[model samples]
Target chain A: MNELVANLGVSYGDVLLELSYLLAAVFFVVGLKFQSHPLTARKGNLWAAAGMFLAMLTTLFLHKDADGNGIALTNGIIIVFSIAVAGVLGAVIARRVKMTAMPELVSFFNATGGGASALVALIEFSNPNNSSTLVTLLGLVIGSVAFSGSLIAYGKLDGKVGDIFAKWTTYLNLFLLGIVITIIVFILAGNISYDSQKLLVYGLLVISLIYGVMFVMPIGGADMPVVISLLNSFTGIAAAMGGFIYHNQAMILGGILVGAAGTILTILMCNAMNRSLFNVIIGAFGGGGAAATHEQGTIKEISLSDASILLSYSQKVVIIPGYGLAVAQAQHICHELDTLLEEKGVEVKYAIHPVAGRMPGHMNVLLAEADVPYEKLIEMDDINPSLPNTDVVVVIGANDVVNPAAHDDPSSPIYGMPIINAHEAKNIIVMKRGMGKGYAGIENFLFFNDKTRMLFGHAKESLQKLVNEIKTL
Target chain B: MEQAFEFFYANKDAIFIIVLSVFLGIEVISNVPSVLHTPLMSGANAISGVIIIGGIILVGHADVSKVSVNLILGILAVLFGTLNVVGGFVVTDRMLEMFKKKK
Candidate 1:
């Protein structure tokens, strides 16, 4: 293998490898462009995967060492074996992971990518001839933070972690951030001798890891999508540092793309909640607080037969879905009820809030999984206007997005946030097991509206029973 | 100041690529509808797995004959990077598969 690669010559291999990287970058850009619409999204993903496959295959065969020689057979075997095992493991896990758990799975994958980048920097910095200290250190710090922060996010999303929202947590996070920046400056100041540089690097790594944990410690569940997006950007920039260190064009382009995408998403999530990104970072939102204790009006209960009749008779109905819908795994049943209503000559559409579920667009994915037509799923802005004229609005396992408090109550924690205007509809039916605050831990005033009727039960059961009732009606 | 200029001059091409790619990324992603947000995110996450190439380079250059830090870290990097790349793309494809037009 070595002789064959040696015959090919270093310049030829390097040129071919660089060309492959360029082709891979093209695939990624085209792939991302294809993602703008649902029709091209799956094909776009395949293009990006092909780009990844080509880049990896080229690297495996054409990669040259400092001496301009192909990789040793032993090292090649190690790379192939590790990649094969990890690739199979990743595919199996991804294939079997539940759709509702997609957010945590994304966070878990982001963590591994960050960990890999950090390890790359660590290994490079250990090299005696390494000259790019600043780039390496930046990669180390950013990668470590992304690695640890993403892990905490995964834990939070998986219900394995709890929020620690204390006033002191904010202070503690800021203090650790200060230490991390200060230490980085000290290390780069040239005041430290070479003998102690490794110690300082290790110290920086540990502090950054701690900072990552503290950064995410106080963020409530509702605000997690923003935090995850922000950390995702961090991982991208960290990978870009690796690109800078190695002068790798493919890494630079791919990293910048992800960094920009994550930044846009973070801002979008913050905007959807009508909150500033700074406030989200300071952990000022979500979780139960003084605001949640405000007094509420009496709830009215509606029978399944009445709810069924209301839906069956309505000219137009909009179903607002939230994280609760995903929790009950009732998407299929929900779809069935909607399909039945459509058959009855009643118009049915789903209104999706930007941050409706655990992650951005989570509700859309769940509904799409149930084979809901792409056109039937409407964005909040698009659906809000028609919501008023719609004869019936069914609040299915959703709360925060429909809460009237976001519009009318200034003192409310969710005030100034845009809502679906469900109160404006002529009839409202809310499906829930009991009167519980939303993930943001705020009482929903929409439940008390004159037109609203609470239908208490698990989402799947309620939807199933409703479907059966509608059939009888 | 001179040192900064020298560094910039040496890496100007890379800097150019980074600037253009950032704008391109923002332009392309800004238009994505909310319906495709999850899949788009997962797709970008997979692209970040390009760091797997970096891992491959590290591993290829590592000395396999000895129990050294380079070998251990290099192998781990490859393993994690591969997981991120393969898993990210596969999961994204799975999500996108569900999004279909009305029959």
Candidate 2:
């Protein structure tokens, strides 16, 4: 019976399964296209979920093995149980994670994607299919690295681990890469027996894991977005390798999309920070203290009443938020303050830098959590030209992004990086906790500019104070 | 080992499809606005979570009802893949839910 099914090469159930996968792939493409905009994004998500459900149900009920035996009844139950448990856990966590912790959650989830792909390659290789050996090995290497790298990124984002930059660490990572490649070449030679080959493969996995951890250990928090993006690309490519190994078309389609997206995102991240992919890979910048060289300006302070009056009467106000806003959990109050200012007829908008907060668009999500209108949020370039004509610019807990030194001061480590142009406004009021440098570890000259007044305090407390004062005025 | 290359060579159509899909993927995601980049990343993570299919096939076709290395690994793959897909889509939806157009 199995031989007969094989000879037919197009069983009815198999043909139906293939069509379902094709439908699922089409849904994925359309879903991604919808996700590019705010209006249809929710429907797009549901469409993709439907596709996933369709593919999963078909696989569970209709899939047959090379021997043509249906899924073992007990294994089917176990598979369902595992999926249920994981889906519930994921849904609960996703619901529970705050906007402030989105970066950590994203990093952790990317790790799981990488880990799953790696496990697939590992299990398949344990059985030693000769024809798919190369792709399996390739998947194992990339997936293992992405898994470890993403975990390290999560740790750094959560502040659980600190940078461990040593000149030798970079060399150590490169050395491990060399060993990984050498083992791949040896395995491809096929001189070793199966048992010994398993040991060699395990060796490769361990080294790849080590290299991944080391690869991320040297970079500081500010560089995390690019690292996360690059690792995302790695996971995508790794999953694609699994698809190739198993002849899975859905995996192939999904993996390539993610790979392309991740790669593009990484490039965009580098461009946003005015850095090269090579420079970023070299693990340079983001020392957190690398920019603390000069202290050549007098402190300028703003009184609470004066700050409130200034904002309440301003014709236009642009607010710039940063990682500091997240640290203070002040997004809600900030939005409230913006609302209050608007009621008084002050035209208010937010200038969002791409690298603001921890991840790409991290600040936007944070502000959105506070129910800020999407139109009030403006990109850096779109808002910069408007800044000079603006009456006042209020900067909240943001530092490096609003620094003027990036355009001048060649000696500054952040030179050539684009900033918020907060200096261009008629009045620049900066709200912060203290006279600390930003993530790049450099002092912001904009604070010393004659047009700037520093209103130093906790971001939430300061915004709350300003909001109260605005009502009184 | 040479046969592995031969197998890949025989699947030329799959290769062509994969390569073409790669370009399509890049083109589609290349212009995702910076604001949606995080959701895009999370959403794509969910899509790649389709590797769960690969895991399902692996454990399902193990040819036995008893415990084996394959069984354990397949279960683990299912768990991770499900978490990725579910967590990714749920979080993306959660984020998108908060976005409202200006009144």
Candidate 3:
């Protein structure tokens, strides 16, 4: 079938190929537009998939030479088999990855992206005709870093890796990066022998992999969202480098889109954490959120029934969700409580910190899964002003986001971070497993505030109890 | 195997688009509301999977010298690019599908 199609396609292959690729790019744009809203997201994805399929098909059947011959039989077979297997694996992973593990899964995907782009650069460099040494090196180095960095990110998120990077690790990382640059400059200057160039490529790949791992090791957990975004952008830029090597328009455009978006995301997340892009890259903010010297504080407990009453009669209530919410899978019951309160003529809203949860947008996705209205899910800036007027604030599974030290204590690691003003509310109800510190590893001064009341238990169980008690009220 | 300068000269327009699109992408995706950030990231990454086309073209280019190194690298590129495109779009779809607007 493919042979027949290729034979027929050879007649007007350029037009067919270019037109199909153009259509696919259009679909990608439309699909992205669709993804912005709940109503159109699924269909948008389908459109994008259709685009990818069409692009793949054109390359497979219509790509031909001056003599009208097709791709090498062995190469064609290998491509088909690999795609078939990858499609199956992708489908399985898409189905199997839990909501809580999305961040790690994303990192895993990013690793593949980075690794793949680097491979393309390697092959292009090997081809004597493709002598774009600069472009190849950019793709090779950035892609390798993204690959290894993402793996470490996955390990960190999954808790399989621990932070052991010390102050000297930074100096070593800089030194290694200097070495990578020196090798690239030599190759670009054509100072290396042809035989040794290949060896240098291998050496470069290894050093980049080490650099990537060292990068994330000492960075605080509070800055993970930023690191993840930065690495994601690296993958995009790397793809563009490969595209430059291949002179492929679609790859270039697609890479540019992702690289740009990821850059913006990294910036926004860094701003949310009150850190500069420079600070994040230098990674001097070490400790991985390890425990700090904590101040003593008195704990005040609130009864389930009292919590229900306080929530039931409140004029306005805001729920601040953190990683613990997703960790305990409390989003569903939390939404149930949201509705239960809203049904009683109490206004309810969700205050979402950008860096909340395990990854970017983690709480929003979980809450949206629970059928929370988009309007009720508010950003920190939009929600903080109303926080002072909120009659009751229910903080579920969240910690550093609501910690007042971000604003009040300059000595705190996360001192300058923007947080929800949960403490400003007339009543504050904190649902936690214990008095455990948040990811920032600092005592939540809000926990010791006069208005704060701790309702301790698993987030899911506690929210369920709140639902049950609210029904009685 | 055109040298770097010739390749740049020929695809100046393409390079220009790449640089321009970087800014455009950032502006368009600036505020994707946190709820959609993950899906959008996945979606954006899916777009990068267009590198699959590059992989396919590189290995399958009619002018490609069937050197063993080129063949092996091409195969690896195909595998990685396919995995990225397939996994990225599927995961993004799965994430988007899970969003149920409040009743």
**Residue A123's lDDT in candidate 2:** 87
Whose TM-score is greatest here? Answer: 2
Worst 10 residues of 3 chain B by lDDT: B61-70
* Model 2 local distance difference test score: 0.85
For candidate 1, give the docking quality class from DockQ: high
lDDT of 1 by residue, A1-473 (tens): 66766776646678789999899989999998898777898899999899989989999999886777788898899999999999999999999999999999999999998898899998888776566777889899899999999999999989999998889988887898888888777877878787687888888889889988988888887677788888888888888888887778888998888999889978877888888999888866555553555566689999999999989999999998888889899999999999999999999999898888777788988888888888898888898988779999998888988988788777777888988888988899999989887866777878988889999999999899999999997
Fraction of the native A-B contacts that model 1 recovers = 0.83
- On the 0 to 100 scale, the lDDT of residue A348 in model 3 is 93
Q: Provide the TM-score of chain B versus the true chain B for each model in turn.
A: 0.94, 0.85, 0.77
Sorted by lDDT (best first), the order is: 1, 2, 3
Off by over 4 Å in 1: A1-10, A286-296, B1-3, B101-103
- Candidate 1 chain A: 10-residue stretch with minimal lDDT: A285-294
Winner by DockQ between candidate 2 and candidate 1: 1
Instruction: For model 1, name the residue pairs that clash.
Output: none
Q: How should the candidates be ordered by TM-score, best one leading? A: 2, 1, 3
10 residues in a row with least lDDT, candidate 2 chain A: A286-295
Per-residue lDDT of candidate 2, residues A1-473 (tens digit): 66776798758788778889889888888888788776887778778877888888888888887667677788798889999999999999999988898888988988998999999998888764436787899889999999999999999989999989889988898889999999999988899898899999889889889988999998877788888888888888888887887777877887887888788888988898888888777866654443456666777999999999999989999999988998899999999999999999999999999888777788888998888988999999899999999999999988989888888777777889998899989999999899987777777888888899989999999999899998988
Judged by DockQ cut-offs, is candidate 2 incorrect, acceptable, medium or high? medium
Residue lDDT tens for model 3, A367-447:
777778877889998999988898999898888889887887767788878889899999999999998777666678899
